[model samples]
Target chain A: MGGFLAGVVGACAEAWQEVRIHKGRVLLSLIGVAVAVCALSGAVAMSAIAQQATIEQADSAGGRAATLTMSMQPSDSTATGRQQATQAWFDVLDRYEISYASRVFWGSSRVQFPDSVQEAGMTVVDQPYGEMHRTRMVEGSWFQPGDSARLAPVVVINTPFWESLGSPDLATHPTVTIDGLGGAKAVIIGVYGTSSWDTWPSMFMLTGHFESLLDPVQAAGSMPQYEMWVPPDLARELQTRIQAELSGAVGAQGFVSVDRSDWGAQMDDPTTILRVITMVIGGIILLLGALSLVNIALVTVRQRIREIGIRRSFGATSGRVFFAVMMESVVATVVAGIVGVILAVLLVQSPMVSELVSFGGISDVPPFPASAAVFGLVVATVVGALAGLIPAIIAVRVKVIDAIRY
Target chain B: MSLIELTAVTRTVLIPDADPLTILDGVSLRVEPGERVSIVGRSGSGKSTLLNLLGMLDLPTTGELSFEGESVPAMKPGRRDRVRGSNVGFIFQQFNLLDGRTALENVTMPLLYARGPRFWGRERIAADILDRVGLGHRLSALPGSLSGGEQQRVAIARALVRQPKLILADEPTGALDVETGQSVMTLLDEIVREENAALVTITHDPAIAARSDRHFRLDRGVLTVAEGAARNAGRADEPVTDGPVADDAVAVL
Candidate 1:
């Protein structure tokens, strides 16, 4: 054991000496390994963070909630009449004790504020707990039951609508005019933030106020869309009850849409796909790094052929020669890996990188875990061993007689 | 007992695009402990080949070679390495000191290879040997930084560090000028005498050969000793010059 330790120490010393002698070459090799490792770690951390954000968004959007939507049909006899269809669906939900909200979609038209006029789509809701009103509000207050009677067509605008109106002070009293079949008199009451329908301008108003603006014929002809949000325990029961009752109601189209919240389901997911891709790319980079290491080791062995023979002649066994060369490679790789990981962390943790990624909805860069560090070390060591194998064998294979002769 | 013995040893070489070459044929010789012997021959006369065989770096194709009554041909590579380390030390013509290491490090290398607690103080042992060889001031210098004579002295220090029973020098001073070569030979002779170790020096220089206790000539695989020279000479024996051929007559026995 002592001899083995000595051999290792001697080998390390000898390798360090050689590296010092050719400092430029050693530095260049280390740089190559460092760059490769940095790229690998950065890509891995980015992918992990992106996937995590996606899952969080999906969970917040109610991945498991069940919902039912009802729309009135204009072209049917008594069975498809718009008012009758909405009442039929409400009755079914009430019978089943299913929690639900009704939304009446007014047609898309221009909304006018004091300084600006913008195209907006308006959806009328009965309560704040309804699906559309459940959107997170960035500023101002939500509507109450008396807001429909006390205020004249009060509106809750999204960020885009608020921004288009030159960021008006909606906290005091703000009014927006909506141009429907009736003249534009809609008022901005509140400002809210939402991840849904991010590309378009939109606003929300109380269902009673919106109904007051519509003529009896237009209100009867316009379909009142209803959305039923059911808890997991009552979801199937509510869906079945609503479907049965609404099939026979006037103006009922056989359920215009049935959906649960899936806001980020399609856009974001975390799985083995990114990991596999990273592994492949990282594996290729690692392979190239190993090849270069082997090339360097082979050159070193060739340059030291005479020295190897002299050592062997003095009493070094073939095993000792092999071990000496392998140790050099392992030391080089391990040092390079450590440097690479540090560089990667610096890059990912930088304010610039974090800020740039946050614009794309990712706020944090995940840390390189201990498992990753261990993996990097193991990869470096294995690559070093593989790279040194040929050179170590060559060193031992040198004939003592021929070496002396040379 | 003879420290080195070779009987009917033959070494052959097979080369591509050519007939097989016989480097050494049935060469038989023996050197007892504390003896100094020189093998002299022209280039390609197999003198170095004989030295290699004696150094245990190469194997004989036929017959038996022994070191201190143990057969060398039957030794495994590991055993052979042990024997080479413990029993025989070598100095080469080119002074093969590792270029990356300091003179002291090179000298200590053999002791480092020696398997025992004795190797623990190898640095001190190496420094002592270097001091004895007049290289105490050059211990920290690399081979490339030293002159040829200084490098050869370092090599000699390395060979002596193990305290081996026999020293095999293959044209140790062959690359040096005549004056430097003679000085190196004198230093070797003094060191060998001081250590009480046998020395087998292979050289083509008759002047260097004349300084040894016994001088033999090799020609076309045959080793012949000088005729009138005594087989064993006392420390005070005078140099003999009955011509080089006189060495062959003594070996006829």
Candidate 2:
């Protein structure tokens, strides 16, 4: 055991010396390896960033993982039929002990923006919806507990809508009049960036306030829908139970169909696809890098044939010769891998890249993943081992009597 | 037991679609520890082939060969390699020192595979050997920058650093001038004696062969006793009495 360890240490030291002596050759070959590793690691890191951005984009659209969105279409368009559906939603929420339930009502209204009224789209949601969608307020804040007590309904408007409202400051409690069923007046509670919205002049308000603005004729068609944030593990169970109960309440098996698809699953589609594509690309780049290393290693072994012969004559075993040659490549590539990983971290995790990827939508860009870095280094070492194997065997086959040759 | 023994050793090379070429036939020799022996041959005389057989670099086609009473031909190739590495050291005609390594590193090569204290104290052992070879000041010098004599001295130091039981020198001083060759041989002789190791030198120079304790000559793949130690004190001033052969008779084996 001791002799084996000594042989290994000696081979490593000899390899390091060879690397030092042949710096020009080592540098030329290592440049290829470094660039290849950089490309692979960079692709991996960029994919991770893209995956994060995709998840965030998906979160803003339908919701994050474990978010079960239930949509019901009633065959009977009667007022009692829709009311029964809404009552079924409430009963399900109550029975399941849901703490983050929100009734969402999508509609449009004419807003009086101090000078003129402009038609705009509005989303009515409860407080949990703000937390669920990870909405950030640029001015004032999302709905507070006291907001429910105010006689006047409060609303959140995006920057474009705020600008359409003459950009009034929320500290003064600006009021925008909505020309709906009763022409209700609403106080502007907060302003948000328009990142999450696909359309300009978008607004958000409480579901109760939105329902109150509706008359009997409009209320028959546009009922407030419910979205509840549930734990990821229990989402499927809750979805099945909710579907079963709603079907039972409506007294028809296929009368009401619940859209229980989690948007998080949809988000994973792009991530998984990107991951596969990136791995294929990185693998090709790494193979090219290995080829380059193997070419240089073969040349190096050929050049050192006489030296190997001399060493063999002076008590070097074939194993020692093999190890010395092979370790030279391994050590060189491992160093190059570390360099490439550091460069990748700097390039991918930089604020400029994060800003470019986020594009004013995703605020929290994750740190450069350690798994990608580890993968790069591990692959580099494996590539070195594989690339150096053939050449090392050739080196070991050099005849000891070749020392007699010039 | 003798340090080396070979009986009825026959070596032949079979070229494809050609008759088998016999290099050595029915050759036998024995070498004891601490003895100095020399084999003189004209060029193409199969001296290196015989050296390879003695050095365990090549197996005999037919022979009863043993090193320290162990059957060498019967050992596995890996075991034979280990035995060769541990028990024999070689000196080449061209002073085949690795180009990039310093004298100390070149001398330390043998100890790298050794176990125990030799592996740990390799540098010290190499340095001490270099100092003994009068190359202590040249330890850091690469072989390219050294003089021929200094390079040969470094090779000698490398060979003896492991303290092997046998030393095989194939035209050890063939590339050097007469003065440098004599000095190298003198140093090799002193060291082999000091280490109590056996020495086998294969040379084409009659003057060199005359200085060994026992001398043999090889001609047409046949070996025959030449002379006893006619000049044991190794007077380098002696003139060659034998006429030179026209052809360079030492065929590379």
Candidate 3:
């Protein structure tokens, strides 16, 4: 056992010596490998960041994963029946102790801007809506708990709407008058950020405040979009239960519709498809690198035929020769892998690249993915082994007399 | 026990679409411990084929061959290789020192396979042997920088570093000038005597073979005892055996 271990150590030392002696030749062989590893690791790292961005984009538009949304129409054909079904859902929320749930209602506010009265798009939601939808405030806070009782309705306006209001300071309690709020001035408490495509002004206000001041005619046209977040494993069961409960309670028999409305509900997720594409491309690059490595290793073994013959004459067995030759490739590639990963980390972790790949803003820029580093190293080692096999076998088959005579 | 023995070894090489080429035909010889033997032949006279068989580098096509009284032909290839590594060393006409390696590294090469004490103490042993060869100060010198004679001396140190029982010298001085060749041969002869090891010299120069206890000439694939050279020294008490001898195989040393 000791001798076997020594043989391994000896082969490694011998391989290293050969590498050092022929450093220029080895360097020529490893350029492709370094580039390949860099591309692979860098792609994976970027893919991780991009995947998070995609999920956040989806979450911001719909809710987080496993969100169940429901809607209902009554056999009586009145809005009151649907409202009652929504109330039943709220009751279910309280009964089940589901922490993250939101009622989404879309309406318009008649804002009395200094220039003119502009009708701005507004989403009326409960306090938990900000957390569920990954909402970010640009200027001030989201609707805090107890914000619904401020007497003066609080609203979070987007940049366009905030600019329309002359960008008022919230510390001074700037107010905006609305046409249908029964003459009560609405407090502009926060500014909700919008994406580049959001050319029109938009706002978010507490559901309680919106309902208290809402005109009956405007409320008749809007319906509450009820959504609840549950653990993914329980989503299917809960979806069925909510559908049956709402369908039975509304007396619509089967008129109620309860299903997952968030981007997570989509069967064909774009992020997953993108990830597969990235891995395929990474694998191809790695294979090309292996080809170059195999070519160089073959040439190296051929060049060292005489040296190998000399080693055999001195007592090195066939196993020793094979191990040594193969180890040269493994060591070279491992070093190259390390260098490539470091380069990728340096490039990817830079703030510029991170923000750029995330489309300028992501809720959470994930840390450099550990899987990318591991993948790079593991792939490099595998490639080295594959590349070394052909050369090692060729080297082992060399006849001692022919090689010495060579 | 004899250090090595060969009985009627025939080595034939098959060629594509042609008659078989016989490299060595019915060759038989023996070398006892601490004895010196030599064989001389012209070019293409199968001197190297005999050396290859004796050094355990190649298996005979058909023969009964033994080393240190064990049947060598029947040993597993790996076992044969190990036995050769531990018990036999070779010096070549071209020195065959690894290029780009220092004199010390070249000498330490064999000890890498020595495993225990030798492997662990390789550098020191290599340095000591190089010193013994009077090239200790040049241990760090690469072959390209060393004179031809210094390189051959390094080769000698490498062969003797493992202290193998059988030393196979295949035209060890063929590439050297007369004086350098004579000096290298003297150094080799003295080292073998000091170590009490057997030496086998195969050469094309008869003068080089004249110093052996037993001398054989290989011509047209046949080996013959050169006149006035056989049984001249060492192992005189034992008659040249004609057939197989019992072996108390010790596995491997």
Candidate 4:
């Protein structure tokens, strides 16, 4: 066993020396391998970013996974009836210890500037909406525990909306006056970053605070819907329970409908197709790279025929000669793999790639995955072994007498 | 016991569309431990074929050959390789030093397959042998940087690094100048004697052949020793019994 290990170590060292001696040719032959590994690992790293973008898109359209969104259309869907329905939904949410819940209501607020008035887009949400949607606060903070206890309704406005309000400082407790809230003032408690679609001014206010000052005609046109987050495994059962309980509380038979927002299912269909496409492309690149490597290794072995003969005469067995030749390719490719992976990290983790992926939306760039690096190196070694096989056999078949004659 | 013995060793090659060509016909020789023997031959003679057989690089057809009392033809190829690696070393006419390797690295090549502490301490052993060959200062020099005689000296160091029982020199100084050839031969003779190893030198020069303890000639695929050369040698106790002995006009050593 010791001798076997020594043989392996000696062969590896000799292989490294051979590579160093012929580095120019080795580097030329290794270009294909380096490019293949770079592309493969880069694709792997980008997949994570792609997946995150898919989840974010799904979250914006529907909601995150394990979230149950309930909607109802009752015969007596009056303002008072809607208030009763919301209260009953809240009771059910509190009973289940559902920490995240929001009633999404879109409305336009009449914001009065110093010189003129403008109608700006506003979203009414509970505190958890900020976290569930991966919203980042640019200043101050999301709704705190005592935020709802303040006299004026606290609203988190985007940068554009804040700028429309003359860029008031949050430290001085800036306020804005709205038309429909009986000329009441709204406090700007926090400022959040803007998305690409948020061209106009936008603000996020508490559901109850917005509802208190909402216009009845506007509320009638767009009804508020309740969404809540729960554990994924318990989502289906809880959805059924919530439907039954909300129907009983509101006395609205066949009106309540509960559905789960499955982000994983939304992600699987398209991403699986993407994954297959990626594999096909990566496999072709690797195949071409292997073919190139095989060609170069064949030529290299042919050129080293005399050297092989000399080594055999000096006590190297045919097996040793074969192994030494094969290991030269293996060692060279492994080093190239390391270089390619480092290049991949630099390429995939760059700010330009992140900017391209985010598209000025929510910046949710994930860390470069370690699996990609491992996969690249393992594949490189396997490719090296496969490429070197035929050449090593040819080298082993060389006759010592014929080679010495040369 | 003799370090190597060949009885009626014959080597034949089959060519396409032609009859089998006999390369070596009934060649017989024996070298005891620490003995020096030489074989002089013409260009097309069977000297190299016999040398290849003695070096264990090729097996004889329809002949009995043994090294240190072990049958060479009966051993497996892998076992033969091990025996040859551990017990036999060769010096080629071209010096045959690896192109890009240093003198120390070339010398350490054989010790990679040796057994015991010698395998583990190969670098030290190679360095000591290179120094003994007066190449200690040129340990890091490649073969291209060294002259013909210096490269042959490195080749000799490589051959002796394993301390084998038998060293086969196939025209060791064939590529060198006369003066350099003599000096390289002297170095080889001194090293072999100091190490107590048997030496088999195949040469085309009569002067080189005359320096050995015993001299033989190979002509037209047949080996013949000069008259009365083997009579005073120590191996006369054994006589040819397995194959046809040479005629009275020729003595087989």
Which ranges in model 1 have alpha carbons more than 4 Å from their true place?
A53-114, A119-271, A354-359, B17-19, B111-125, B227-253
Off by over 4 Å in 2: A72-88, A111-118, A136-141, A151-153, A159-199, A212-220, A247-255, A264-268, A358-364, A403-406, B228-253
Arranged by lDDT, best first: 3, 4, 2, 1
Question: Which run of 10 residues does model 2 chain A get worst, by summed lDDT?
Answer: A253-262
User: How many pairs of residues in model 1 come into backbone collision?
Assistant: 17
Give model 4's docking category: acceptable
lDDT of 3 at B234: 31
At residue A223, candidate 3 shows an lDDT of 68
Residue A156, candidate 3: how far off, in angstroms?
A: 3.3
- Per residue, candidate 1 scores C-alpha lDDT tens digits across A360-396 of 3432335655555666667777877888799888988
The C-alpha lDDT values of all candidates are 0.72, 0.80, 0.82, 0.80
- Cand. 3 TM to true fold: 0.89
Backbone clashes in model 4, listed as residue pairs: none
Q: How far in Å is the alpha carbon of A93 misplaced in model 3? A: 1.3
Candidate 2 global lDDT: 0.80
Name model 3 segments beyond 4 Å from true. A73-86, A108-120, A137-140, A157-199, A251-255, B228-253
Residue range B150-251, candidate 4, lDDT tens digits:
999999999999888899999987999889999999999999999999999998766666668877767767777643434433333332112233332234
Query: Which residue pairs clash in candidate 3?
Result: none
Compared with the true structure, the alpha-carbon lDDT of candidate 1 equals 0.72
Candidate 2 Cα deviation (angstroms), residue A169: 7.3
Instruction: Tell me chain A's TM-score in each of the predictions.
Output: 0.63, 0.86, 0.89, 0.89
List, residue by residue over A225-326, the lDDT tens digit for candidate 3: 887888878898988887777777777353777788778788888698879988899889988889988988888899889988887777788888888888
Question: Cα deviation in Å at residue A71, candidate 2?
Answer: 3.4
- The first chain of model 2 has a TM-score of 0.86
